[model samples]
Target chain A: MSGLITLVSLMYLVSAACYVIGLHMMRTPKTARNGNRVSAVGMIIAVIMTFLIVINKHEATMTGSIVLAAGLILGLAYGTIRARTVEMTDMPQLVSLFNAVGGGAAAAIGTFDYLSLTAGSHISFAFSFPVALDLVIGGVTFSGSLIATGKLAGNISGKPISFPGAKLLNAIVVIVIVAAVVLTIGFPVNAWWLVLTLVASLIFGILMTIPIGGADMPVVVSLLNAFTGLAVAMAGFVIDNQALIIAGALVGAAGTILTLQMAAAMNRSVMNIIAGGFGTGDSNSAAADDVPVNVKETSPDDVGVQLAYAQNVMIVPGYGLAAAQAQHEVAELAKLLTDHDINVNYAIHPVAGRMPGHMNVLLAEVNVPYDQMKQLEEANSMFENTDVSLVIGANDVTNPAARRKGTAITGMPILDIDKSKSVVVIKRSMSTGYAGIQNELFSDDQTHMLFADAKKGLQDIIASTKEYLDE
Target chain B: MSQELYTNIAIFVLSILVGFEVISKIPSTLHTPMMSGANAIHGVVVVGTILIALEAHSVLFYVIAFIAVFLASINVSGGYVVTDRMLQMFSKPKKTDDQKQDGGDK
Candidate 1:
């Protein structure tokens, strides 16, 4: 039996290494598929190891093994069904649900130990602490993730919903929870406070997440994943399991870092994110009403004429690029221009998408070389020397408000595309981003509007560029 | 222990169903913000772990507690890092055609 456990542990270690490699591959858009394969391989190995360990350890009772095997089969079937049917748009919500399942599992292990104690099992204090911690955190993650999933799926309001005295009420609830925990430690036999704390945590999870707007769901999801990891680590401590402790800790740390990075990308403080209700529905509505300048836009043929003849071109991508799913077409256009002896490079702003590094992922999807995607700092200087700066589906991130004070988006950093020679913007219409403000970029004299769908516009541009080269 | 496990499994399944029911109706645009807010609530995990760590009554327990604390700190720091990076866009500039100079003449 000990040998079986050791073998399982060895497999787990190997699987962990594979997972690390897979994650690295997924980071860049180019190798994302390869990364998925690696991760899948790792998961398969881990699953096999888990079964082996479970089978070896159990007394092999027919009833117990049958039940366990049946549960596993059911889980596998459900996962397969969901994976086959879920759309890409719903991927984020699915991720949240999966995370919730992991959290629930951790909490379950802890509760089992607690109940055992109640049934005359003599457990050490060390064991009890981890179990209790896991119960609270895992429970919260499970509930909170559900709420997040609900909001993302559009079953609930994505806007921050608040009532009078909401902040005060939240504070009170937190205080009560802390107080309950403190009292539970001071008086052990009466563990009723622990139960009360659980209730408080559940309510806190719901209330805390309810008021946040839809714009911030990715950050919320990452943070909850961190919680789930921490809860798992606590459970590991209770069970004296080294592997669980290490794995949980790594995930917890990584998830937290991801959350922080996501929040930073939006220029919001974590505290503000937690305490403040985000999104004003009226502001978005008002911003939407900001009428666009109906300039007689140039056609892709004309734009291609300029691109094909120009010595240098810089492509600037924003959130619009992702929405249009035009990255591949843009890549094709760039390749065509490059073939015609025109220099083409992609200028990427750090915060150009809904999340940090979002543009990178989109570009990678289209097989854009890593070297071709220039960082904002690197691309800024090049723009001044370039003949044309093509803007695609980007708005707020490129707005000059980051450097200009007294504006609604003041103090936010922006790309220096204003320094370029000529700019071409491809947009369906002049629309505001999450901040709900008009883009002054649309009115600039050196800019020409290309009013069309991003993907269609890019495709036409690609064809025209090829025609120009043929000419 | 088995009975408790059964109850937990039931709760876990119920939570998933409840969550699915709630999330399926939200519009695509709101998904990002909703997840962000929920992540904040997940911080309770840190507090829970710390509470557990403090309950350690033996040397081995102390070692585990110390490790958990260290890892949790890193987790907190990482969350902040990612958040800061995401927010940097607010101050970033937009790249529009009208704002540029005619560098071709240069």
Candidate 2:
């Protein structure tokens, strides 16, 4: 029995090593897929070793084993199907949903452990503390991630939803959670305290997420991911599992850094996003109506002629591109231009899509070369020398108004598309972006608007460019 | 604290440091895949669920453990599969290899 314990411990260590090495390999695009495979292998090892331990103990009844197996099979089938069939455009919501389940599982484990503690028995601080922490953090992540998924899937409004005294309500929820934790740990084993903690934490999660705007989802998602990691770590402490501790701590640390990085990308603090109500939700349409600025409208044929004849072109894509599933269309257009020897590169803003690096994944799906996707600083520098800048379904990222004072997006970093010789914007209409402010770039003297959906507009431009090249 | 508790704490702290060090190197373009991959790693909770289930004799405990097991399994399988699907796309374009070689020469 002792020997078996040692072997199981060794296997768990090996699994931990796989996770560390796998994450390291993800530093480069070349090794990222293999890295995921390596991590999956680690997971398989951990699961098998756990089974070995359970069987060696001979503690599981036949009925218990059957129930466990059934749960595993059902979950595996459901998860695999969802992962395989989900559209790439909806990857953010799928990720959020995964976070929800992961958090829910951790919370359930913590709750079960707390309940199994003998009634009227003295619970140690060490054991009960982690239980409380796990319940609170896991509860928060589970509910917060579900709300995020709903917002992303358009079941709930993407705009920030807040009411009077929302912040006070949030404060009250936090206080209640803290009081419940103290009671559970300081007093005898009372399930009521745990119940109170769980309920308050769930409400707190919804309160924390509901007030955040759609554009701030990248940070919100990353933050919830970090919460999920912390909750798992707490569960590890409750169960005294080394593998869980290492894996959970690793994810917690990494998710924290990712969240901070995303928040920095948007020039906002995590606290500011959590406070919510940054975006006003289309209220500035009145402002746009007040100013009747001159706008240039162009046809696909004319835009295609310019693109085909230009020596250099830059493509700036945003959430609009992802929304219309126009990545493939745009990639085809880029390829056509590349064949014509018209230098083509894509300018990828850090916060361009719903999640960080989302636009890159969408473009890479259609075989767009990774090298052709330029980061913000690099893309800004090249725009000055480019002959034409094609703005596709992107708005605020390229808006010149961001540089000036007193606007919604003021002081926000923007793509300098106006620095190019000429600019063509492909948008459905001259409307405000997520910031609820008009894009001054739309009315720039050198800017021309091609009013159409991203996919259809790109297809039209592709056909017209072919015609121009043929002629 | 017990000797075992001290050891667990030490392991947790070291793992956190390693996590921060390893992930800081990943570029922004791969952030989504990296995030998804990390999401999969925390599915280690499934082991905890299974352990609890083994000891569960009561119907209430069994039901709770069953749900936990189900959710953790989904998190593990779905998170990894989706991340792999995304990363597969990242590595597919042949031009990326040529571009790397060109950069190497420069």
Q: For this target, which candidate reaches the highest TM-score against the unseen true structure?
A: 2
Candidate 2: tens digits of C-alpha lDDT, residues A134-224: 9999999999999999999999999889899987999899999999999888999988988999999999989998988788898888888
Docking class of 1: incorrect
Model 2 RMSD in Å is 3.2
Q: A-chain TM-score per prediction? A: 0.80, 0.96
After superposing candidate 1, which stretches have Cα over 4 Å from the reference? A1-53, A59-64, A80-91, A119-125, A150-157, A179-199, A277-302, A354-356, A463-471, B1-106
- The models' CA-based lDDT, in order, is 0.59, 0.89
DockQ of 1: 0.03
What is the DockQ score of candidate 2, to 2 decimals? 0.70
Shift in Å, residue A401, candidate 2: 2.8
iRMS values in order, in angstroms?
15.9, 1.1
TM-score of only chain B in every candidate structure: 0.52, 0.87
